[model samples]
Target: DVKVTQSSRYLVKRTGEKVFLECVQDMDHENMFWYRQDPGLGLRLIYFSYDVKMKEKGDIPEGYSVSREKKERFSLILESASTNQTSMYLCASSLVSFVMNTEAFFGQGTRLTVV
Candidate 1:
């Protein structure tokens, strides 16, 4: 089975702190994504990388950034965290299969709180 592992399950940080959230997948999938989940806004994509050393910004890319130096790992970085950025962050990976549609497998998520 494919597994997405997040570095931290919960995090508390002071305002203006820099944060790094790590994610790794063992399935050798081609795509990886980062999303922030808020109550009303639902899951909003922050960034995604389709291959090593390549990435595309998703809808909400203002305060978030991503790195994909390797095929199995993707990292999300908050460059100067803020109070409004407090939310649940999820990491997911998937493969596009021509024979059968594949679904993205999500991590348990890392809930981040900025004070």
Candidate 2:
């Protein structure tokens, strides 16, 4: 199976703690994205990487950051955890191009709670 999956399904962090959410994709996809899912806000992009060591800030990148040192792995970092940052984080991968972008494959959601 061409897989995109998170390493962690649940995490708990205290305020001011740093958190890392890990994901790996085996499809050799060129694009990977991080998004957060909230009850009212749905899914909002936090960051995306189009290639290794290259990344772009997404709609909600203020408190979050990402790393893509390798093609198959993408890591999301929360510099300092906060109660408001508690939410479901999702990782997605897609093979994309100007001509035709393919459907995104998503990992199992990670539920993060900060207290």
Error of 2 at 115 (Å): 0.8
lDDT per residue, candidate 2, 15-70, as tens digits? 99999999999999999999999998899999999999999999989998899999
Q: Which candidate number maximizes lDDT?
A: 1
| Candidate 1, pairs of clashing residues | none
Candidate 1: worst 10 consecutive residues by lDDT? 94-103
TM-score (C-alpha) between model 2 and the true structure: 0.95
**Candidate 1 residue 65 C-alpha distance from true site, Å:** 1.0
Kindly report which residue pairs in candidate 2 clash with one another: none
- lDDT accuracy of residue 40 in candidate 1: 91
